[model samples]
Target: MPDSTPRAPVLQMPQVVVDMKLPQIRELATQLRFAPEEGRIWMDERRMVLVHSDTFADLREELLASLGYEMTRGLLTRIYFAAGQRDAASVLKRLGPGASLKEVLNTGGRMHALQGYLLPEHVGRGLAAGDLRSDDYYGEALWKDSLEDEAHVARHGVGQHAVCWNAVGYCSGYLSYCAQRTIVVREVECRASGGNHCKIVAQPAAQWDNVEEDLRFLLPQPVGRRARIVAPVADGGPTTALAQSAVTDSRDDDRAAPRSLAETAFVGASTAFSVLRHKIDRVAPTQATVLLLGESGVGKSLIARQVHRRSQRAQAQLIEVNCAAIPEALVESELFGVERGAFSGASQARAGRFEAAHGGTLFLDEVATLSPTTQGKLLRVLQSGALERLGSNQTRVTDVRVIAATNEDLKQAVRQGRFREDLYFRLNVFPVVVPPLRERRDDIPLLVQALLQRFAPLHGRGHVGITSRALQALIHHDWPGNIRELENVIERAVIMLHEGEMLDLQHLSYADDTLSTPSYFGLDDTGQLMINTDYDFGASQSPASTSAASPAALDMNRLADDLLRQGPGQLAAMERALVRSAVRQAGGNITRAAALLGLSRAQTEYRYRKQQSAPG
Candidate 1:
């Protein structure tokens, strides 16, 4: 069932005069530089006047002319009985006869009372009476953080720096009056919840500002003890009923969040997986260049395929080009194609990656390694959608989508002049960063099962599954080479597995020696000394030693042997200990620990969190 809810209203203040008898109050407001046109005063339920307050000085003269009042500056407290609303007498009377003038000036409590008057029953009846327009009831809630600072000055006099809260309150109140509805103004601190710095919320004033000037023209001239009803006025205004119905229909169309491609296509429910899939969907349909960034062996090519599969041009072929694998001199011809007899190597006409991918996509792997000349040609294709074949003057126009991948930082390459800025911007229109296997560690078991199923059938061997302990080890290991490394390890393990056996840690190919060593302490996997700690020379050690073994030597040989036989759980524990020690020494500085261990900050942090969350 579709939901139905009334939206809030937008409000606008009108320019009008404020009747003031006291010259001193007017003088004070003028000295404060408040403009009169921005605020109005109500006198004895019969007269309405405008006053100039310095805060809105731009509208001061206009406000005076509108009210047919002389533009003069003076104190106004004694002269102005009430500001805003032709029905002020009844509003003030409801506040009680003995209410102090100060109580009336206290806007917060009065504002709350006004909200109470907007009860659903009252609003419904008002709508029925044609006195209240439904269009005046709905508007988007806008919050400005700076309102509190402004309010503080309005409530309390601005000392050195003049703050205008009166102007704010007057403007907000007049807007509500024009809308014939209550408006709530909330002054909220910007940084209170570690969100925005400040926010001022104005609510339920619906389109008030949009039609306020028209409302002012339609307002009846003041008469003694009663608000004179003027003739119905229309500034060629559209019917409010239509607006109300549209708002109602729009509410039905609202959704909490958008559905992802994985959710809609494969019925996948994992949020992380769905987010990645959604990113692919958004980037697929457009010709905008996409940069796919992920660690090595993280199925970047698989993601590229998914993008191509979901794209409109999926009927066309998707060509893959590994930039790093191609010779620097031949990279341009490979991408842009070459004419027959263009060069010594070009014996026949050959369509390049771009031509082959016409009406489809060209996937460039390791794009950061492209030669500067290749980068320039790629930029031209992206900019002009036209390419020149090698040794040919004719330009071929190709409608091809581009998807580039790199594990390295292209931005850094651009800064170093290794990558062209124009090409980088063109190709980096949308960037999809594929998370490493370690990030989506929960998927490790699924991947392992799939790999085992595939490899077992290929080898003509019985199907095998990983034991819980072995799986734990696989999840904990820092997959430097990512999925490719995992696949190799699983394949090797499957090859070595015996019949009727669930694979255990011993069956796995990874051992203590295979793991990277800790360079900071000069420690290997088995606590063997790879560096001499006896060197007292205080100098920055080589980056290579950051992952080496500690200099201390003990039962190092036995420890290494034990680690080799033990499962990944044991190795993970040792790694955690090393990380914790480094973090403690660095005073919880993860970056320093990462530098000490020759690991990236993200890698160090991930490992730390994994250890922290592991079951005791």
Candidate 2:
């Protein structure tokens, strides 16, 4: 029995305008500037580090020549797939959320050409008038301009359909994000296969006739943890192919987060995560049923989709069934199709989740909550890939790879006689355990960076990162709710900040509410902003009451009185506060912080030293 969830509303695209010409490639390339400044590289407001083409090309050649076609292609696909997602997000952000479909498609395609990937030629008429590219004008990719194709041909002879696997994955990922649906692209013609140039077509998943076969190439293959440069062959045989060797820092290509993570709010990389990641890689390409064991908020559904992406069903939809969310009475009719007049309210024959997920993956989240009767029906479908409509005896054959996830221990349920033992064993052919966030602490930094990148663009409050001290505070806490909890915290922090203020976390609330412990960013002695977590703050402790009991409140009043008496900071008090706050926010670093205040390091140090000497 499959759980039923309401489907997402399909997005309607804009009606196409005649002869639409987007921003030319030349103008877009001009905006793509590379310059290093302020101890970091800058591409406009975004922080970026520069890389030369030869350096990248050299690495690409080595990876392909040494790792063989399968290993290299899978590795590169994952890397660029992530890059495509981030690029699409940035493009959409720049274009504004409400831009018309034609604007997004035309500009996105032009950006692809400008980025030196493939030259996308307009296919059919123009932008299709829906969430999907219509049959009239599906997207097309021309191969003559692909940098990757040229690089491959220069070293390895053209031998196959299309050697540009990375670009195909990249285009597919970018367009999919734009369409708000899963779109797959594949090479139909290629220069590598002795054609004049490489050419490919893109379509929404429903439009693909042979999606099951195409899904295999999209699976996340296990890539090397690191890569090293094998010096180019002195014999001039284009001997730069990457062979496995000592580990190097070549894996920093993580854009946003790894695309293999799939539609998740967060991702992490740590030894604790390796077990599940390895299991996903090994089982994704196979037909074996997988049971994901994890705690709530551990991202089980996203991991399930990742397995689908890497399996033979990438071209099909990943239908999710939230068992606990569905009504108990409707479970039967929802899992199997319902015929017209099957029940009092059955108006027409309708397909269920099983029918919808034909030739794809069906993810049953929280499968442990399933009732005993539903469990038996699910077992029947698992044993024989055939099912019947609720009111009809006619049977239908379906091909779906089932992946079930649960936060509960199914073994305990079976022993308690609440769950069937046979069904449990059938679903447990391959089990992958997902570790909680507390166990994978090493991945916090990467997760934070990735989360900030996503949240910053939406709220415009993450131009600068939090202080290391704040980061330490985040890492030290044990996350009971896991990644979902972390996401909420980051969002709250973003909302609290104003534009142009760097994120300097001063307070943290492990609990859902921080009402009693209101966050106040105060500076401490030694010119450093200190995080005062233990302070009690609320309406009860408001300033009106504090005048009677708090020395700090008394001091502030006295300073105000002094300012009023002597007239507007006659004591030079506010200036001192500003200096101290600057130093504190800089994490007690003197010189760098002094610069933030537009003062020379030596001058500020000299004035502070003189003040100390003159003190009584």
Candidate 3:
């Protein structure tokens, strides 16, 4: 009687990349940029506008009243489904090249968090590294703080059905785009239906028992409410996998779209970049000698490339020479062609950079470092496109457009007699001053994204996100070494990160002076000078707190003393008592009590309920 029956074995979930590391929450916030002066808010390249939650609730209530529940659900689901598809495309484009399939899939959750939809936690495993296109693929996730559920519950009270219709549609569309197959993500449990939190399960459409029921909402019109089936029926025809293969085979002539040069090479959307671009365009078509002035590592070379690309001679070769890198004795031969036996070690005749760049462009970087003798030769080439080969006075006629760049002041060099004034005038026909990285702080996020895409694959880190603190640090730092220094820091940080880890502040290596923490001096209530280290100031003060002493400030030292006096094992009891007192002070209003306790309403309610149930 005790033991003849066999027990069913517990089902095990399939393993996937559950430990997907995300960018720090703070870092995600930095992606949203406010430009009140320009009357715009931007999240990456996309424009965004903030809308009140109550406004959304109003819309939802109106829709429910007008269209009825089923129609409203279908309408909202299809709308959000389309939005999710766009989000998928934008996110994939933003992550850029070298991003792994896992990163692309994992970032979908981050995208939800970024848009204030919900926070997704994988229940057992994530589908980040799994085969998303598989017919039997299944993914389970728990959603906390779902905005749609909260809105629905607030407007309509507790619903009889799971009410996260938007989330379901969004996840379905997003996953479908990423997997290139119809993925039906159903909200199995929702707070509006009296569940603790929203829980969702996703599977390829064909694998779901009620796939038609789930996808019917995605169809248009009144038919969506009455339709029993949708396209790609669960039981008939070829599977999504076979269909995808057929499509792929038929699209052999289709190619990936070309990326913009500005997005890939000269990534920036700042006003400063726009102005620079305008200047480059103005002079790029002309034969005027261009001078690029900027600090070292400020991407003068990239500016030069942009100019060359936009020029009439773009079809020909572009020869670049770093004048400072060559020896002073070899500068003349490097600029002007050299014949055999021109120098003691000269063996064979070779064309100089100018001859090599015939009917093309010759970019001279750090041109200020060229010797006076070499400057004369450069002036001759710029004046008449004529140059003499060293040790052979045969003047070589060549047609070339010169684009010179330098970190040093060429005018000052001319004044100092290190460079010829005539040559300086010739090179200064159209001077383009590239702004430093610090001057255009708004462009930092774009640059960081580009750098991450470039360096992550080189170090085999796949796609690494940066912590919020790290991004804040990058934004605040005055990049004295300019873009080049930023490149080194990003590449080094990528190298330091292990697989499945985000780049953090600790991984960054900056100049000692740049990394130094400065002390702050402020006047306290009595106008007496008060000094605080940044650490103390930031740790002690909240963003809402003013310079004056705040009554709500926590006396950490006193609290610790009291805690020590109470000894161990009393922390939980004290917390319960504190929560209970806060509830009483707020007259049992959980929302007000949560504010008093500096906790969320849900948290305060949970604790108060727990305390009331505990035995005394």
Query: By TM-score, who's the top model here?
Result: 3
Per-residue C-alpha lDDT of model 1 across residues 160-253, encoded as one tens digit per residue: 3212232234323433434445443332322223323232333443434443322222222223111111112121111232221111111111
Candidate 1 lDDT (Cα, 0 to 1): 0.50
Q: For each candidate, what is the lDDT?
A: 0.50, 0.61, 0.68
Candidate 3 local lDDT, 1-616, one digit each (tens):
1112332211111022233232233223334544454455555444577788788778888999999988889888987776666566556655654668767766777667557677677776665535788777888888767788888876667867888888888888788766766778888888888887788888887888866787778645423321211123221111332221121111110221323433343655567876787898899988888999999889998888888888899899989999989988888888887899988878999889899999899999999888777888788888888899899989889999999999998878888898899988888889999999987766676578667767877777875777543664576577898888888889888998889887875577785524422223322222222332111222343322222322123234334434655568777877987898898899989999999999999999998888889899
What would you estimate as the lDDT of candidate 2?
A: 0.61
Poorly placed runs, candidate 2 (over 4 Å): 1-266, 461-464, 507-511, 514-616
Best-matching candidate per lDDT = 3
lDDT for each residue of candidate 2 in 271-322, tens digit (9 for 90 to 100)? 6765566778899999999999989987788788788988989899889999
Which pairs of residues collide in model 2? 62-240, 62-241, 62-242, 63-242, 219-310, 528-584, 529-584
Instruction: Determine which window of 10 residues in candidate 3 has minimal summed lDDT.
Output: 244-253
Rate residue 318 of model 2 by lDDT. Answer: 89
Ranking by TM-score: 3, 2, 1
The regions of model 1 sitting more than 4 angstroms off are: 1-272, 511-616
The count of backbone overlaps in candidate 3 is 1
Residue 598, model 1, lDDT:
88
> Deviation in angstroms for 601 in model 2?
38
| RMSD per model, one decimal | 25.3, 22.3, 16.9
